[model samples]
Target: MQQLNVIGLDQQGAEKLGKKLNKLLASYQIFYMNVRGFHWNIRGERFFELHVKFEETYNDLLLKIDEIAERILTLGQQPQHTYSNYLDNSSVEEAANIHDGRECVESILNSYQSVIRLQREILSAAAEIEDEGTASLMGDYITEQEKTAWMLTSYLK
Candidate 1:
């Protein structure tokens, strides 16, 4: 579905950005799911606290995912969500059941940092192409991811 309002960005550039953004989106979705998974199954000393906090954090991540995916679709491309598709494109790796809270925190922190990096790159490319819509989207995702990384890491500190 075309967003109706098109920018002066080159078509090729827009497509490139769309691909990168979708890849990041897939990674983010998988990461958020992992967060929620642990949130539900989490047990240990900090069970109650970690459980509640993890759910809240994952909720916020979910919202960000929606916004980011919308931005990609608005750029005249579909957001890819299939596992195989993500496996092929996402720079971030999916979480295996090989981690506890400490490890989870580390994994999520790395995921957020990686996402922020990817979003930054996408923003630069979008701006260079004059795609204000995508650039703005990338800006929003970057800020949100940064905050999320902070919150997730705070559990360790």
Candidate 2:
């Protein structure tokens, strides 16, 4: 008998997607903290603008983190929640003491690249399994993050 998850995705494919989503969730956690640090520790001429932008970025990450966790649950897998787990699983490294706005934005852009790449992979996996829910989520994230990367790149230029 073929097993399907709650959303009718094949269990094996859903499990693979869940694992990838968990990794993404971990990256998002680290990236969220990094953005919070940027919001709090940002210095120099663009302080006012970058500070608010970082806050908005982190807030958006927070929402995505929740959505990712819930998606994992919907896939019939547990979402990893511990900091240790996130640190171990995440590709994005922690950014510490980034006082300069350019450096912070660059770090953000780099992290977005990592996330966007992983999300693209997940999108492929979801598409293979006909998982429209996960595919749609990744599509939305990729589009938004790509625009953000472009804007940040422009800021640096």
Candidate 3:
């Protein structure tokens, strides 16, 4: 008989899912830090508004990071927790010293695009293995990120 994970997902598939989720976790860590930078350094005419928004964004990213890590654990794999590992594995690059509100918002939008794409890929993989837990998580992230992207784009316009 084939082995299955805690959630009844095929063992091999669950392992793959856990790896992908770890990559996602890495990306979220970098992105979360970047958003925190944006919140702290954002200036110019939109400082008051953008600062608050950036804080909200970083807080949300923090929550998602925790969720992704827990999901990896649920899938029977260890989540990568070191900054070195995150920097090495994540596609999202770290942003430094960004002060302009528009530039920071633009960077956030770009990062969200990358994350949303990855989540969609995860959704597909999870669906293939009938891992409803992962599929649901990815689906929720994609939906919320898409709407946030739309709002950020409008803010930029």
Candidate 4:
């Protein structure tokens, strides 16, 4: 007999979803750290504004990281927790020592694009297996991030 997860999802399908979520979690972790650096190191005349914004962004990313990790656990799989694991699995690259506000916003926009694309792919996979929980989460992230991207782009202009 085929095993199922606590939520009644097929074990195989849930396992695949868990792997994908772990990758997303890793990317979020890298992106979170990058934004934290941005928050700490950002300079320029816009320092006050960008500093607050970056703090808000990283805080939000931290929440999402926890949620993704919890979801992976709910799916009966372990999340990638270490920085090394995050580096290995994440598509987002680490940003270091960036102080310029424009540069930080640009880097953040790029990370948003990467994550949104990945979430869309995950959304498709979740939909294929009728995993509405994960699908809804991806959809929400995509929508929120798209709005954030637009705002950041305007900030650059």
- Candidate 3 per-residue lDDT, tens place, 1-157, comes to 8899777879999999999999999999999999999998888999999889898999999999999999999999999999999999887989999999889989999999999999999999999999888999999999999999999999899
Worst 10-residue lDDT window for candidate 2 reads 1-10
Alpha-carbon RMSD of each model: 3.4, 0.8, 0.8, 0.9
**TM-score computed on alpha carbons, candidate 1:** 0.85
Instruction: Provide the lDDT at 21 for model 2.
Output: 98
* Whole-model lDDT values for every prediction: 0.78, 0.95, 0.93, 0.93
- The deviation in Å at residue 119 for candidate 2 is 0.2
Error of 3 at 126 (Å): 0.2
Q: Please give the distance, in angstroms, between residue 79's alpha carbon in candidate 4 and its true position after superposition.
A: 0.8
Model 4: lDDT to the true structure:
0.93
Residue 134 miss distance in model 2 (angstroms)? 0.1
Model 4 steric clash pairs: none
Q: Model 3 RMSD to the real structure?
A: 0.8
Q: Give a tens-digit lDDT track for model 1, residues 69-116.
A: 888777777898788887787777877773367776787788888888
Better of 1 and 2 by lDDT: 2
